[model samples]
Target chain A: MTYCIGMRIDRGLVFMSDTRTSAGVDNFATSKKMFTWCTPGERVVTIMTAGNLATTQAMISLLEERSKSQEERDPSILRQSTMFQVARLVGSTLKEVIADSSPNGQTSDDQFSASVIVGGQIGEGRPTVYLVYPQGNFIEITDDTPFFQIGETKYGKPILVRTYDKEMSFEEAIKLLLVSFDSTVKSNLSVGLPFDLMVYETDSFDTSRQKRIEQDDPVYQSISTGWGDALRDAFQLLPSYSV
Target chain B: MTYCIGMRIDRGLVFMSDTRTSAGVDNFATSKKMFTWCTPGERVVTIMTAGNLATTQAMISLLEERSKSQEERDPSILRQSTMFQVARLVGSTLKEVIADSSPNGQTSDDQFSASVIVGGQIGEGRPTVYLVYPQGNFIEITDDTPFFQIGETKYGKPILVRTYDKEMSFEEAIKLLLVSFDSTVKSNLSVGLPFDLMVYETDSFDTSRQKRIEQDDPVYQSISTGWGDALRDAFQLLPSYSV
Candidate 1:
């Protein structure tokens, strides 16, 4: 299993994904789920996927191949004028890859299964984040719902639902994401470190501030420790029953 | 949908359940999910159900009816010699009720599904908690996995995983539960307010402290506020990325 989250705030977009992949308990490995398609000043597109490992990797490989061959890139994400077109290109590519992998006569549903969080900027509009489903359709994040999460999302959803604000500063959004990710990591063994976290500042059109967060990182340690202690203190403060 | 949790701690047992029942968003109603059968100083058994409302209600109603009858009431949960036997009784009753509700020849996989968390003490043994499945079999909570959650559990799992301790004080456990419940309420619309919470101390053989937390309760207000602030603060303290 995997855990990935994408946030679109006033400042820009934040994307994070875990690196653990397991076929079962005994066979476990690490795979990079974050992929970037950037053509310098033209456009910046980030794709993070979760689901069957082979399926996601195949789609990424096909997308990369298309990137190299000018003719095949489609209403190319690198060439698309708007963020919406980029989502379509990614969704279509995911669908195409799944179809190609499965045996003949198998429908789209049976053959392929993968979901993606695609976010970045193109031209002069606001940064956008989209959650692309397995069926090649997508939904953009709104102000009321400024975030999208996939793969082990429930454990981290509470933090985002209660505190996520569309007008939040980029730094604040990043911090909130880390805490949310920490909660997911603590709850699920399937999702582990190091984490791929990227913060795209509004109108920057580039992944100017993106870093990999590791298990022993000081910042992560602080967030985990502080959050736990705060919870204990808060619990102590609630009035207890005296029956 | 519902969210119910049971914690087995050194202090005793903590059980909390939400009352929201829905066939869909358009059809929503409130129904109690926690039931207690105590024979005063002799024994105390608490059952919390989740899954098909009709199935659970039927099982409980049957048990209640049997307990009211003079002959059958003596050998039931009210008269079981051990906690294990009590669990077995509950499981057997669940199986019987489900079988009676849906005819064997036409029952679907989940036609009459129901699961329960049964815990308490009887005749000088330490408190025990068991998660009874629809198949009339159950598993006791162990030291490593000391908690059981049924129906809409994933949304609140992180808090329990992060804050739960085998030796936590009863006070600590209740607060942890509230925060966990708060997390679930924020994430899933199906799991709503007016939570039923009960806490029993080891050897007490009674429901020492129990309360129903409403949407606007003062203590719940504090929990939601304090938890949100603490989460944001924790996120802020994390190290920022290098741009």
Candidate 2:
């Protein structure tokens, strides 16, 4: 289980991913789900994946191998002319990796399934977020759908849907994301710290604002405790239901 | 999809279920999911079902028919000595109906799957809640697990886990449940109003505070709007993450 969320707000884009991966309750490990590629001032793509660990790792490594020096068979994400093309490249590469590892030419098993969220900016293109499905298809975020969440998504979604604003500052967005992640981590054991977060200002085309939040991170601790306290207070403030 | 939540707090047990049932986005209709079998001053058992509407309805009807004049076909849930027995009766009845409806002897397809949350007080038995699975097995709610939510549950779960108090008022419980349902209704198209809510005060042996909350009810409206506003306000109160 995992929880990764990406938002395309008016000011920029935000991506957050939990690091825990598990085959079962007993077999659990921490793996960085966020992968970054940047050609400063040209393109910056941050991809977060959920599902089969090997497939995602293979996809990222394969992309890295091919993108190092563009050949006809493999191309660089940094060279993708637009975010849409980057998403397509990531989607196709994910599909290929899963297919290559599937036994008996069958991608039928969910063990081979994986989903990716690609969010970034390319040159003058707008910053955006795309949710790439396991079947090598993807959909970009729009104003109506300002964010995308994959893996263990339900527990953390209501807060996002309720408070997401198009014009909120990046600080506000990060705070909101932390609250959402805190809710998810508390509810699901499979999703836990440390969390990876990336904030990309629109058209920056350079990846610099990124952080790995550990369990004891003071900032995170304060936010988690503060949010819980606020929720209790907010819950109490609601008008009591009358018969 | 349906969203039903059963909470057992110090005061008593509370059950809330959404009425909207949908086979697909296009085929949605209102159907009551909350069923109550109460011999007031004795036992008041309320069951909320989610998943295959046919299976749930059939199971409920079968239990009603067999329990009506139990000559041998079935036993009365009202006469059950304990809430656990009532839950077992409901679970077995559910399993039996689904098995009878299956085209093949095997329960291979999930189309026949359904889950139920049964909560109430039987005579002197303490107010309790049990989650009955489709496979005829059930788990009773413990203090550590004060609530059970079946189907489309994730969206509304975090709030319950965070705000639930063992000694909160029934009014507070109802308010909390409505907030949960409101969040679920807004996020998922398949779950909607009107919502059936039953507040069972411990040892009361009566359900006089039952209400069916509609989409435009004033109290519901205030909670829904108030919750959204309060969440946004709370989001603002959180400390911003400094990079």
Candidate 3:
């Protein structure tokens, strides 16, 4: 299982994903779930994946290979003109990978299925986020629903739902995502640090604000511990129920 | 889908369950999921259920009928000698109901399957709780795991994990539970109010502290609104992450 979030705030797009992957409880490993392809000033594409590790890895590898080979460049993610087109290419590639892995064509709930969150900016276009389903369908985030989360999503959702602000700065959004991710990591063993993070300022077309938060990263550790203390204080402040 | 929690703290047992049940998203109705049987000054047993509504309803009806009939009282939940025995009775009754509803006996994952949380005290026994599986087996709650949640459990779990305290007063515990339930209601359509609550003080053999918290309950409304405000404040207090 994995936990990933692609959030679109006024400042830009913020993405975070856990690296933990497990075949079973006993066999656990860390695998990067965030992928990026940028053409510096032209287009910036970032994707976070969850579900079958093999399916996600295969889908990403296919995208990487296509972008590198001129002969396959027709469907390459980098060649897409807009974020919408990039989402379409990603959906189809994910579909293709899942179909190839399963003996029968992939069902949405198939063991080989994977979901993706693709978000970033393309030249002159507004930054946006889309949640792609295992069936190759996708939904773009809107003002009413300005973020997308895939995999092990429930434990981390309440915070995102309550605290997310459309006008938050890049720093605030990162803090929010880390708090959300920390809640998930503490509640679920399947999701853990170090988490990969990427911040895309609209029209920057650069991924330089990206980072990999390790277990001992001071900022993350502070947020993790501080959030817990803050939550306890908040809970203590609520009015008590009397019989 | 449903949300129910049975928690054991030093003050005794606390139980809360949402009443909303649905066959499909568009088809929903309110139905009580918490049941209690008590012989004042002798014993008190409460059970909260989740899963197939039909199976849970049938199981409770069977228990009610058996306890009411003089001849069939042999296996009645009310006649159980201890909380452990009551759990066994509830588990077996649940298993029997699922088996009768399904053409094949019953699989743990059968659509007709349901789970139960039974907790209370009998005679000189200590207060305790048990999570009964669909397979007619159950495990008693220990100090290490003093709470049990069934159905749509994740969204509300992080708060409980962070706030639960063994020595909390009944008032504080109830406040904690309402916060937990409020979180679930905000995030899930399948779980909603009015919520049923039961607080049993150890060795009291009483069930009089129970209350039904309606959607418009003043205290609940205050907590719900207060929690949102407190959380926003908490988020603001966390240190910002610098890119």
Candidate 4:
């Protein structure tokens, strides 16, 4: 189990994911889900994955291999000039991996089934977020649906659906995302910490701010504390039953 | 789809469920997901259902019939002396309904699955919350669990998991529940408006408070608005990027 959230706000984008992975209750462990491929000032793409650790690791290795070889590359991450094309490349690679691992076309439920939120800017266009499905197809987040979440998504979905806006400030976006992430962390034992967060400014082509939050991280502790208190206070302010 | 939340607090128990049912986005309808079989001063049992509208409706109908009938009564809800027995009664009824409905035998995914959260106090014992599964079995809420949710549970789970407590006041419990429900309402279009809330105090067999919340209800409006603003305010209060 994993929890990864990607938001495309007016400022740019915000990506956050917990690093916990568990095969079973006894086989629980941690692995980073966020992977970054940056050419700095030209392209910065971050992918966060949930489901099938082996599949995701393989996909990441393939991307890294392409980045290294540069030759025999069929429109690799570095070669793809647009975020849309990059998503397609990643999706196609996933499809291939799934096919190779499962020759009988009977994919294991625990096979290469992963959904990714791929977000970044490639040129002077708008920052974008695409929800890459397990089948290697994807959907771009529009203003109507300005966020994409994968893995233990339900826990964090309510916050995103109610609060996400295309015009939210980067600061506001990150905070909303943290509350959403905080919600997931509290609800699910499968999704634990430390969490990885990256906030990118539109057209900057580099990670403007990135932080790894541990369980005892002071800032996260404060956010989590304040959020609960504020909710309680706000809840009290609502009218109780009169009937 | 439905959204029902049940919490086991030190003072008593609180159960809330939205009454919306839909086959698809277009075929929207309303039904009572909240069912109460109370003997007034003796016992109070509340069951809320989610998944497969026909199956859930049929299960409730069967339970109601059993409660009303005189002869065919091996295990009736009103006759069940303990909360555990009551759960067994409900689960047995569900199994019967599914067997009747599904022409095929119960396969893994094809089984008629309806999740239920049953919470109430029986006689002198403490109020308890149980999450009854499709297999006619259930689990009680411990200090670690403390709450149970059925149908579209993920969206509202974070609040319950993080903020719920055995020592929480009834008022606090309601507020936390509303926030959790609000989250569910926003994320899933299938789970919708006009929520039913029933709060029961430990020694009081009669409903301490019950209300039906419409979409335009002022208190609900306040809850939604207040939670959103409080979330934004909380987000803004977080430390911004320094690098």
Candidate 5:
């Protein structure tokens, strides 16, 4: 299990993903789930994946290999003209991987299925985010729903639903995502630190703001502990119920 | 789908359950999920259920009918010697209902399966809570885990995990639960308003502190709105991340 957030704010796109993967309780490993492909001043594409680790890795590998080869037969994700086309390429590749892994064609609940969050800017297009499903279908973020969360999402959702603001700065957005991710990490065992984070400022077409937040990162530690105390204090302030 | 919670505090026990039950998106109805049986000054038992509506309803009806009959041919939940025994009775009744509803004997994932949270005091026994599985087995809540949530439990769990205190007063506990339930109601269509609440004081052997909070209830409305504002303020108090 994994937890990933792809948020589209007025400033740009903010993405965060947990890096814990487990085949069983005894067999756990750290694996990066955030992938980035940028063409410097032209385009920046970021993806966060959740579900079957194998399926996600295979899908990402195909995209990476195709982009490196000059063969026109294999469409490169970097070659897509728009963010929508990039999302389509990602969805189809994910579908292809799942279908190839399963003996029978992939079902909606196939064990090999994976979902992806693709978000970034292409040329002069507006920055956006899309939640690509395992079935090769996708939906872009809207003003009403400015963020997308996939995998182990519930424990951390209430805070996001209440606190998300589209006009938030990249720093504030990272703070918000970290708080959300901290809630998830505390409540669920499958999603653990260190988390991979990427902040793509619209029109920058660069991925230099990417960072891996380790378990002992000072800022993350402070936010994690501080948020818990803040929550308890907030709970204390609510009006009490009486018979 | 449903959301129900049974929490044990030093003051005694607190229970809250949402009443929205739906067969499909277009088909929904209000139904009680909390049930209680008490012999004043002697014993009191409360059960909150989640899962297949038919299974839970049948199980509750069986308990109600058997407890009303004086015949020794059938066991009565009211006659249970202790709260533990009451939980066992509830679990077996739930398992029996699921078995009867399905053609083959019930499986762990059987659609006819249901789970129950039973808590209260019997005779001189201490008030306690038990989470009964669909397999007719149950585990009593300990000091380490003083609450039990059944069905659609995730969205509302972080708040409980962060703020729950065994020494909390009944008023504070109820306030905490309402906040948790409000989160679930706002996020899920399967769980909604008009929540049922029950508070049992230890050794009281009474179930009088029960109320159905309607959607338009003033206190609930105030808490629902106030909590969102409080949470946003809490988010702001956290330290901002810097790139």
Candidate 6:
């Protein structure tokens, strides 16, 4: 299992994802889930995946291979005219991989299903984020719902629901996301540490601001410890339930 | 849908449940999900239900009828000598009700199934809680996994996982529970206000400290607001991520 979040605020788009892949309790590995496709002064695209690792990795490999050749694939994300077209390409690529992986007609939909969060900018096109489903379909995040979370979302959601702001700074957005991820890490085993975080400012079509938060990073540790103590203090301050 | 939780602590057992029931977004109603049967200084039992409302209500009605006339029922909760037996009785009863509700021997298990959290003291038996499944089997909460939650559980679980203590005060437990319920209520419509809460001190065969917290309850509102503010503050204090 994996947990990834993509938020489209007034400032820009924020993408974060945990890198824990497990086949079962005994077999676990660290794998990157966030991929970037960018041209310094032109476009920046970030893709975060959750669900079947094989399908997601295959789709990413396909996208990377196609993006390298100017004439190889007609619908490569690099050639897509808009963020919407990029999302459509990713969704269709994911579906194609799943169909190819299954033998005969013996594919269980749940076994091969995966979801992706694709967000970025292309030239002067609007900066946006989309949640692409396994069915080769997708939905863009709107003002009414400015965020998309996939994989182990509920445990970390309340904080996001309460604190999300369109005008939040890039720093504030990263802190908000880390706190949400902290909640999920504390509650679930499937989602672990070494989160990949990237913040794309609205009109800056470049991949300049990103960080890989690891297991023992001082700031991460402080936030995790501080947040727990704050919760305990908050619990104590609440009015008690009496007879 | 519903959300109910039962915690077994050194000081006592805590049970909290919401009262909202909904078939869909357009059709929603309020319904009680917590029930208690006590013999004062003898044995006391509390049952909280989630899943199919009809199956749970039928099981409860049948148990009440049998407790009135012991000779008519073979495995009534009132006749059980231990908490384990009591749990068995509740699980079997729930299974029976589900089976009885479906016609033509063709029942979609998901449609009629219900789960229960049963906690109490029987004679000199230890005060504990068991999560009774729809299949007439149950598992007791141990010191490691000291609580059980049914329906819409993930959103509220982080606080409980962070704050639970074996020796915390009942006030602390209730405060923790209300915070958990508040998180769920904020994120989901299926779990709503007017929460039913009860706390049972170890070996106490009476239900004394119980309350129904309504939508506008002053204390409940304060906790809800206070927690949100505390989280925002916590987020502000966390060190920000840089490029």
lDDT of 3 by residue, B1-243 (tens): 899999999989999999999999989999999998899999998889999988898898888885466765543777878888888888888888888888977875699888999989999999999999999999999999999999999999999999899999999999999999998899989998999999999989899999999999999999999999999999999899988
Instruction: State the TM-score for model 5.
Output: 0.96
Where is model 4 more than 4 Å wrong at Cα?
A66-75, A106-110, A165-169, B66-75, B165-169, B207-209, B241-243
Would you list the clashing residue pairs of candidate 3?
none
- Per-residue alpha-carbon lDDT of model 1 for B1-243, expressed as tens digits? 889998898778899999999999999999999998887777788899998899899888877775476665553567678999989999999988787777553244666788999988886988888999998999998888899999998878887877788787776777788888888888788999899988888777787577888889887787777777766665555555343
On DockQ, the candidate that comes out on top is 3
Total colliding residue pairs, candidate 4 = 0
Q: TM-score of chain B only, all predictions?
A: 0.93, 0.94, 0.95, 0.92, 0.95, 0.93
Tens-place lDDT digits, model 4, residues B1-243: 788988878888888999888867989988878888777898888888887777888887777775556776543667888888888888887777777777776655754677788888889877888888776778888877787788888888766766667897877777788788888887788888888888888979886578887899887788788887776665566664332
* Model 3 spans > 4 angstroms off: A66-75, B66-75
> What's the iRMSD of model 6?
1.2
B50-103 per-residue lDDT for model 6 (tens digits): 998988998998878855566665436678889998888898888888878667
- Total clashes for model 5: 0
- CAPRI band for model 4: medium
Please provide, for model 2 over A1-243, each residue's C-alpha lDDT reduced to its tens digit, 9 standing for 90 to 100. 899999988889999999999999999999999999888878888999999998899898877875455555443676688889999999999989888877666355557889999988888888889999888999989999999999999889899999988999999998999999999998889999999999998877777899999999998999999998998899888899965
Clash-forming residue pairs, model 6: none
Worst 10 residues of 6 chain B by lDDT: B101-110
Q: Is the docking of candidate 6 incorrect, acceptable, medium or high quality?
A: medium
Per-model DockQ against the true two-chain complex:
0.49, 0.78, 0.86, 0.49, 0.79, 0.72
Fnat, model by model in order, equals: 0.49, 0.75, 0.79, 0.47, 0.71, 0.75
> Of the candidates numbered 1 and 4, which has the greater lDDT value?
1
Q: Give the per-residue lDDT digits (tens) of candidate 2, residues B1-243.
A: 999999988988999999999888889999999988888788888999998988998888787774455665443776689988888899889888888877776364558889999989988788999999988889999999999999898888888888999899889999999988888888889899999999988888887888999988998998999999999888888889966
Local distance difference test, candidate 1: 0.81
Candidate 1: where are CA atoms >4 Å away? A66-75, A99-111, A241-243, B66-75, B99-111, B165-169, B234-243
Error of 3 at B70 (Å): 8.7
Give the 10-residue window scoring lowest on summed lDDT in candidate 5 chain B. B66-75
